[model samples]
Target: MKNSKGGIYKRFVKRPMDFILSLIAIIVLSPIFLIVALLVRTKLGSPVLFKQKRPGLNEEIFMMYKFRTMTDERDENGNLLPDSVRLTRFGKLLRSTSLDELPELLNIIKGDMSIVGPRPQLVRDMVFMNQKQRERHTVLPGLTGWAQVNGRNCVTWEEKLSYDIKYLSNITFLEDWKIIFMTVAKVFKRDGISTEGMDTAEDFGDYLLRIGQIDNRTYIKGLEKSKKIAN
Candidate 1:
């Protein structure tokens, strides 16, 4: 299982630790969860929890949950409006505070994620990654990761993937706790919540296109692959 790369801690202890910690977190955070759920439902209309398919350990797909932060407002053509139009002030508050991520504790308990690892990304994002870059999938995805604490939505796609690789190269108990501590600090500082002046974080494919790293043909292919995987 390549888990030996992380030594005994990653091989034998990580999952159990994730389970225990997540369960405790869920219990302790239950009231906050309920409050957030009610707020999201009342403010966002319905589906208080946002669910999306994300690539996890070994490139496996799983449904990651978060509090809904955008309205489903669409244009006259029935197309969804741009994120800038749908993201409300309340939504931004949820994101900035990281309350939107509270639901992911359930994912950690469910074994689809861990407390610290590479962040799970969109299927469209994974389609753009090469095999070596995708090696981040050798370990489970996390609610908060090395890349997130470093620059999060502020960093370029290439830099984010590099951070993920750097993290997986050495997975230890101390490293995980360090990430957790850094994450707490980052959250309080409200750093890197979104790309400056952007309503939402750019997707990997969109970032590549903006930088001219992939042509229209390759972009279209990736979009198709992402759709296929989602289906």
Candidate 2:
């Protein structure tokens, strides 16, 4: 009827719903959470949780948490190895099974996220978004979302952002529950865990540069903004 964001469910119901569901999930899944934490520590070492600053609602920066999925192994030069190098079999298992994202329930409980919305991206990734694409940040980020269910790491950056924008326009209560169900199916299927031949999805700026959709100077400027936000 209006900008769709004015919908009653989004304005009044979503956050409380997220809070209740996430709290229940944390309680019911406590055993799984503890086991995952211990396994991450035993496999990836200390700091069993992986935390990073992500752009959330209204582009606010908040630390998002996940279980550690990679090692801190550095090289002779004292620089960390590549993700492909540091990510082990166990890490791959966690990623593929989506077990590494368990800690994000805390983010939902803290109201830093929703159970459904655009999945938050790294600040570096957010910097590369144009004004229109950035509208995805108008709502709290989510653990799983339309883009996530549709193609996950399988889709192109453009496609995923399009899905995020599309989701904002369709934020009904039924729509969110539908997405949640679809997400469960996708996770169990472990579909689109990563694009073929890639350890992780390509970063937005890198994708833009590779496809010549953005100039080197523009990407460099985005990098400057990303660095500024991270600090």
Each model's lDDT comes to: 0.92, 0.91
Tens-digit lDDT track of model 1 for 1-231: 234365888889999999999999999999999998999999998999999999888788899999999999998999999999999999999999999999999999899999999999999999999888888888999999999999999988889999999998778999999999999999999999998878898998998898999999999999999999888
Backbone clash count for every predicted candidate, in the order shown: 0, 0
lDDT of 2: 0.91
Compared with the true structure, the alpha-carbon lDDT of candidate 1 equals 0.92
Worst 10 residues of 1 by lDDT: 1-10
Q: How close is candidate 1 to the true structure, as a TM-score?
A: 0.97
lDDT of 2 by residue, 1-231 (tens): 123345889999999999999999999999999899899889889999999999998988899999999999999999999999999999999999999998999999998999999999989998888889989988899999999999999998889999999998888899999999998899889999998889977899998999999999999999998999888
TM-score of each: 0.97, 0.96
Once model 2 is optimally superposed onto the true structure by TM-score, how far is the C-alpha of residue 53 displaced, in angstroms?
A: 0.2
Off by over 4 Å in 2: 1-4
